[model samples]
Structures are given as structure tokens and as C-alpha cells.
Target: MRLGRVFSVIAVCFFVSACSWFGGDEKRLPDIPEQQLYDEAITALEQQEYETAVEKLQMLEARYPFGRYSEQAQLELIFAYHKNFEPEAARAAADRFIRLHPSHENIDYAYYLKGLTAFEQDQSMFQRFLPIDIDQRDPGAARSSFESFSTLINRYPDSSYAPDAQKRMLFLKNRLASYEVHVANYYMKRGAYIAAANRGRYVVENLKETPATPDALAVMYQAYELLGEQQLAQSARDVLLANYPNYPLKSYKVKNTSLLETATFGLFGSESEADDPPRPTTEDKQGLEKPENEAQKEQETKRPWYHKATFGIFE
Candidate 1:
């Protein structure tokens, strides 16, 4: 009978703990308004008490997931996780916030935090030999970061965070392009011409609107040329000519010089009118005589009439 009573107590305790987790006990929450709980969480976070902050913030999130302080609590929890160097935890918190509040005002901030978490967690296995990997550290995560930052800009163009978000987006764009270039260059160096050409073509076709497209197309041109694929080389050359005429490639070098020559000579019109020597007349036999304008008349009046008549012989 005593053992049965002890087992009953343990069962009650387990039930209470399970109930508490699902918000069955309202008294576990602070008596103050939700904002005050958030304020307390922030204070804990400021003191670098990450565990305490997470506890307080998680309570707020659980008890008031849709309350006025829910978003604030969620963001604070993410910050606390990040400050504690637990990026995966931080990302989880951020993801929950985004999924729950898809249309919230601070949704951009949620996305930003998610991106920051992924960026922070980025690392590669081939850190010793090749500083850059042909494949990115975490492309899926990096892509998520890109998407988040892009969405932040598109949605909150006028937000104060917009400027920082814009700069980060540019960095992500360049990094993504760098990864593609790394793969293409790797394939080219390995003599895998088809793979190199395909990788380069991906960048040119999909990211053609970006500044890196020209470089990508040029690399594809080189790959095609080396592989002895005359038709592919010509197609790549056409792409280079169409999109990046100013790029200095072997094919484009002469092509562009000829273009410059054509444009300079053709658009400037024929040099015949400008280069023709003046027709020879009596004026060429003697010094050229000035026309008899008012100023010339005044000057000529100061000279003798015979001298003026002699000068006027050419006129």
C-alpha cells in the first residue's frame, strides 16, 4: 500500500509537469503585464545571463504566443541564443517567429535574424588546401539568408534596417557568384570542358541580369574554345558580344577593335569633307588677302591706296 501511494505521487508530479509545458498553469507566469515580462527578459539578456533570459522569454512566448509581447519575446530569445553563440538555437527561434507571424510588422527582422544565424554558422571542410570550396559551405542555408535579406529589402524599403539589409544582400550576391566561379574554374582546370561550360552557362543564363554574368560568359567562351567545339565557342562568343562587348576576350579584342573602327569612321561620316585641302586660287599665289570688312577697311585706310590695291589683287 505504501509503494502504491509513492507511485501515485510520481504520476501526479509528471502530470503537473506536462500540463505546465502546455500552459495549463497560468500562475507560473508573472503577475505584471506582458511588456514587463519582456523588459525583465531584456534585462537578463543585457546582463549576458542567456539561460535566464531564455527561460523568461520562453515563458512569455509560450504563455503569450499571440499576445502583445509575443514577437518581442521571440526576437529577444533569438538574440539571447545568438549572444550565447548557439546559432542553431537562434535560427530555430527565428524560424518559429517567421512561421507564426508571416504578416507581422517585424517579420523582416525575423528574416534578418534567420539569415544572420546561417551566415554565422557557415564553415567548410576544405579549409586547409583550398581556401574556397567549389561548393559553398552551406548553400541551402546561404540561399535562405539571401532570400531573407532580399525579402527584407523588397518589403521594407524605407525601414531603418533597409540600408544594412541592402549591403548584406550585395555581399550575399557576390558570394553566390563567387561560388559559381569557383566551380566553373575548378572544372576548367581539371580539363572537364563540358562541366565547365555547363557551370559557366548556368551563371550566364540564370544570373545574366547580374554584373557577374559577363565574366561567366567569358569563361564559358574560353572553355568552349579549348574543347575545340567550334559551334559552342561561336555561341558563347555571340553571348559575349551581345551582353559584354567591352570585355577583353581574344575573339572580342579584334571584333571590338573593328567595331570601334567602324563606329568611329562610319558615324563620324567620311573624312573627305574635313581632309580635303582648300582649292588653290590666286590667293595661293600670293599671301591670302583679308575680305574688306569694317575692321579691314579701317586697317587698309591706314595703308597707302596703291599698297591696298596690290594686296586686293588676290581678292
Candidate 2:
């Protein structure tokens, strides 16, 4: 009985080995002709099969590196990667194309694609509908996108993509300026008055004319006030008031709270609670508070020069 069982086990093992030898893996599709592969990739792209298009384009590039369709295939690969949501691959392909054919007629397209890829990469799905402020997030990708678009604009001013690139650059500039303000705000919240003031000053000096400029000035004013730099605070406030008359600076003052009130968490404080009703200020009494027309004017002034020049077409 033991001998019969061992023979059966041996037979089962041999059958398993035979099955593995014959049915290892499915065969790969035969290599398609370069022209056929390119056509297929285009067809897949039209069909919105981005993954298949990327695969076919990559294969076409590998199989026909120097073929007649090579240059076109390389360019298509960047778009394919982008459509497939592979931003890093798209950027790499674009860079490669630009490096390989710097004087190519389609070089501007590569630059535009690089910039677009960077722009898309920086955009989060949450930003589409959420009220999230992009300034609070990392600005690395935004900076890169801005640089890429700037390069495209400077190098190919007359290119078809230049107009769009210029528009994106304006947005990126404002975004970066806002990011600086966000950092300054963070420092202010942490009581790092000097650092906050420096960041705010940086935005005012380096990112002039951006929508965040007024906010940057406000931050600088508040930070300097907290740091006891009354002169600097006054300077910032003057600039902010001059440029943005409707900017609300009434809330920038530091509240005076006694140590006893601080230690007691305001329960036994002499000062009124923050939520309690308060008397109107001098501006309110003088009818110099923010008016609806002033708010509208603020919005109008905040529009970038391009937006004004384009008559809100780009906005």
C-alpha cells in the first residue's frame, strides 16, 4: 500500500511539472510595424484609452528610435504621458525632446508641454471644489511651473503657446506671492514677528503688483507692530493705505490684556470678552468704513495687468 501511494505522488508531481512547462505565461502580441504602432497609438488616444496609447507610443519610440516617425512619436509620447496622468513621465519626455532637438520647429511645443505638466502636477483634486487655499501648501511645483512657463514665453514669444503660457505665469506669480503671505502668516501665528515681517517684506519687494501685495503689507504692518518697530509698522501701513484704501486695518491692533486676565483665562478679567459687543471706531463714526463701491474697486484693482489688457478674456 505504501509503495502504491509513493508512485501516485510521483505521477502527480510529474503532471504538475508538465503543465508548468507548457502553460507558463500568455504570449506577448507580435511586434507591430512602426507606422502601424503609431497609428494604433493615435487611435487609442482618440478613443480615450490613454494607458494603451502611452504603451503603444513607448513601444513605437523604442522600436523605431531613428525612423521617419521618431520625432513625431517622441512628441506624442509627452502628450500620451500627460493624458495618462503621468506628469513626471510627461515632463521627462518633454525635457528629452527639447534636449535632443533644441532647434526643432516643435521645440516650443515641448516647452509648453513641460510647463503644462508641471501645472497639472501641482493641482490637487481637492482644489477643484474645495475652498482650500493653495498658498498653505508646498509651492515647489508652482515655482517649477512658473519657471517652465517663463522659459517658454521668453524663448518662443511668437509661438502659439506663448499666450497661454503667459497667462499661466501670471497665475503662478500670484500664487507664489500668496504663498509668501501664508508663510508670513504662519510665522505671525507662532509669534515669530521678525521672521513674519521679513517674509512679508520679501513679498512686497520681490512680488510687487501681485494681488497678495496688499495682504503682504498688512502682515508686515501687524508683525512690525508686534515687534515694537513702530516706524516700520507705520511705513507698511502707509503703503497699504495708499495703495488699498479699502483694506481693513482696524483689526491689526494688538489687544491689551493684563497678566491676571491671561492666567485666569478671561473668566475674572476686567476687559470685555472678544465675543461681546463693542463700540464703533472712528472710521465707522466718520463714515469711512469699507463701502460696497470700495470693495468693488478693490476687486477691480486686484486684477492683474494682463487681465485688464485682455479685457477679462484670460480671467
Candidate 3:
């Protein structure tokens, strides 16, 4: 009986294996010609079918890793990923291409795309239409973008992308400077006057000619004055008065973010944390038969009309 049971188990395993083999064969994609795959990917890109383009490009690379169009496919894959709003994938593809083909004639193009990806990494789809303060978001992506552009310019000064990269670098520098002043303002509101002063000094000393210079000098003046350093305060004040006498700069204020913002990064949360939470399960029975449950589906919660239209980005 034990031998019979063992044989029965082996027969069952063999049947399962045969079924899986047939299933795999049925689901396998057709093997298209190398040139045909690359052309389809290119056609999808031209039609702005980014998802389809990404699918074809990815499949081409997987199936023809060393084909005639392999390098070009890899390069276009980065662009496809970028157009599909897959910044992380685009960055990784760009990095891989750069590493594998350091001497490629189009290496500067790879660096340019890497910088472009990082340039918009911090911005969500909602930010395209919403006038949010990007400087208050994060500076890491901005710095990364700047470094990529800088490297491209330094390594390939004569490359056609250098001029555009120079423009982007200037914008990044100003954005970074503005971000520093924003942080300095935050420190001022927290009463960390010394730290605020240091940040202001960094902007003024390291990032010159930026639009935020006046704000930085103002922060330094206020921070030093608050710290009882009259000499340092006067020096900062002197520079401000000398350079931007007409600019009306004031201390920046701290804002209390809405509690609902945690879900959408401060774009949708309008209610404060002080508001009452959902009722307890024990105290929820208020109806004649059964009270409506307070813990309902998050998607069922009522939101503003604008939020509903723009929630896709947050999602």
C-alpha cells in the first residue's frame, strides 16, 4: 500500500508538470524579427503611445540583447521610460548606457537625459498645473540634475547639448539657492538663529548672483540680530542695503500643514489633526437598528471637486 501511494504521488506531480509546460507555451509571446521589433517600438514612440513603446522596447532588448539595434534600443528605452513618467527606470537605463558605452558618440545625450529625468523627479503630475512652491519640496533631485549637467558640460563642452545644459544648470543653481533660503527661514521660525545664519551665509557665499541673495542677506541680518551679534548683523545689513536697497525683505513665517496633507503631500489634506477621529466601534451604534460604520472605505470619503479631478496624480 505504501508503494502504491508513492507511485500515485509521482503520477500527480508528473501531470502537474505537464500542465505547467502547456500553460507556458500558450502564454509565450511570438518571436518577431529583430528589425521588426525595433521598428514597432519606434512607431509606437512616434504615435505617442508611450506604454506600447515601452513594452516593445523592453521586449526587443530582452530578446535581442546583442542585436544590431541593441545599443540604440537601450538609448531609446530611456526616452520611452521618461515619456511614460517612469523616471526611476529612465535614470537606471541612462546610467547603464553611460557605464557600458563611456566612449559612445552620444554619451552626452545620455547625460542630458539623466539630468532631465532628475530635473522633474520631485514634481508630481499635479504640480504641472498647480502652482506649488517646488523650492519647499526637496533639493536632492535638483542637486542631482545639476551635477549631471555639470558633468556633461565638463566632459563634452563641444557637444550640442552643452548649451541647453548650461541653461538648465543656471536654473538649478537659482532653485538650489532659493531652497537654501527657504530652509534658513524655517530655522529662523524655529528660533535656531545660528543655524539660520549659517544657511544664509552659504547662499550668499557659495551661490552668488541668485535672486534669493536678498532673502539670504535678510535672514542673516535677522538671525545675527536675534543672537545679539550687532557687528555681524550690521555687516549683513550693509550688503543688503548696498545691493538691494529697494527690496522689501521680511522674516519668513512657518505654516501649519493640514492633517489630510499626509495622504497627498500637503495638496489634498485640508483638515487639521486636531479634528476628531472616527468614532470607536463600541460607541458607534446610533441608528435604530445599526449605526453607519465610521470606519468606511478611504475612497468613499467625500473630498472637494478639484481633489477628485486631480487625485489621479496623488494616487
Candidate 4:
């Protein structure tokens, strides 16, 4: 009986091996029609299902690299990658499309999208929700964005996207200028006068027409003054005064912030001199007081209960 069972097992093993070696009829998945695949991707895009759209578009490209809709698919893939939060992939796709179809009618749009990808790369979820200083962040992406927009405008001056590209380029230019001013401000607080002055000079010379020009001038003046370069300091100060009359030197910050104050989001204390709220003028106080009687005026002038208890901190 044992011998018979061993023989049956051996026969079963051989049958399995034979089936694996010589295949029976196996069903194949039908190739999706090119038009159908493109339509599905477009539908997903219209529905704002960018992840699905990206998958479909990728599949379409892999299956139909030279199909009628290949070029349009490539363009839509760039947008889909951007919408799906794949900035690097979006930029790669944009560059590839631009290289492949240099004379394409929509080449300008490709450049525009490429610039926009880098333009928004620094804006994170925290920046969207918190009160973060955008100018204090990295400026590499901003510079790249500016260059891409510049290329688009220079190469395709009459393209339909040139107007919006121009606007974005201006925004990037100002942003880059402000970033330089912020760095210079930091260097000033660190007592690195030469570095601060260099950054300020850069903004003044190359990044004109920006709101930060006044701040840059202020930094340069302060830095030169601290370094005992009286002539250079006066030159910077004169230009600042000529352009922005009545500017307060005390309004600029060149001080260090305590760790506790910085960690508490300036709730413990603030280092910024420019952020002080305007004090109420004497005329403004008198306008609020009624002339009913001396007692009534005195009562009105009294602080609120919580304000007095907290020594005016709560108020």
C-alpha cells in the first residue's frame, strides 16, 4: 500500500510540472482603445481626480507613444502631475514636452506651467495656515521661476500666455528682492556689517522698483554706520532720505531676539520695532470722554476690572 501511494504522488507531481511546461489556452486582457483611454483621462481631469488622471495618462503614453493624442496627453500629463503635487515630475514632463515639441503651438503654455511649478514650490501646508514670513524662506525656487518666465516671454513674445507670465515674473522679482533684504537684516543683527552691506547693495542695484528697496537702503546705511564708514553711511542715508522722506531710523530692527520670545511666536515679547501699534493721541482720548460731570468723566476714565487686576496686561 505504501509503495502504491508513493507512485501516485510521483505521478501527480509530474502532471503538475507538465501542465506548467505546456500551457493551455490562457485569456488575454483586451488592449484598451486609444480614444477610450484618452477620453477616460480627460474625464478624470474634468472631475478633478488628478491622481487617477495621471495614472491614465501615463498608461496611455506607455501603450500609445506615437498615437494621435500623444502630444495632447503629454501636455495634460504635466498639468496632472502639477495638480497631484508632484512638482519634480511636473517640471520634468514640462521640460521633456518643450524639448520634443519646440515648435508646438502650445509650447508657450508648457514654459508657463514649468515656471508656475517652481513658483509655488516653497509654499507648504504650514505656510498656508500659519503666519510665516515668506521672504524669510529659501529663494532658489523663486529665482528659477523668474528665469523660466523670462525665457517664455523672451522666446514667445506674442504668445497668449506672455501677459500672465509677465505678471508672475514681476511678482517673483519683488519677492526675490524682499528675500535679499531679509537676509541683510539678519546679517545686521549678527553684526556682519560687510555681508549685510553687500546684500543691501545688491538689492539696490539689481532689484529696483521693489518695495524692499527702502528697507535695503536702511540696512546699508546702518551697516556702514556700525563699521565706522562714515562716508558710505551718509551716502546710503542721503539716498534713503531723498527717496523716502520722514523714514524713522528707530523703525528698523538691528537687534537680537531672545530664544523664549522667538519660541512663543512673540507672545512673550517682540524684537521688531516696526511692529509696534500706534499709541493713542491726547486728542483721541479726549474725543471719547463725555462732558456730563467730573465724576462721570472720572468713572469713564477708570480701567476695566480685568485690566486693573492684570496691571493693564489683559487690556
lDDT of 1 at 101: 74
Candidate 2 clashes: the total is: 0
**TM-score of structure candidate 4:** 0.68
Q: Candidate 4: lDDT of 195? A: 100
Regions more than 4 Å wrong, model 2: 1-29, 251-315
Summarize candidate 3's per-residue lDDT along 223-299 as a digit string, tens digits. 99888899999999999999998978565444666556656686665543343554456643453233345444333
Error of 1 at 218 (Å): 3.1
In candidate 3, which residue ranges exceed 4 Å CA deviation?
A: 1-17, 20-22, 248-315
**What's the number of clashes in each of the models?**
0, 0, 2, 0
Clashing pairs in 4: none
Quote model 1's TM-score: 0.58
Native-to-model Cα distance after best TM-score fit, residue 305 in candidate 3, in Å: 48
- After superposition, which runs of candidate 4 have C-alpha atoms over 4 Å from their true positions? 1-29, 250-315
Candidate lDDT values, in order:
0.73, 0.86, 0.87, 0.87
TM-score ranking, best first: 3, 2, 4, 1
Clash list (residue pairs), candidate 1: none
TM-score of each: 0.58, 0.69, 0.70, 0.68
Candidate 1 worst ten-residue window by lDDT: 268-277
Candidate 2 lands at a TM-score of 0.69
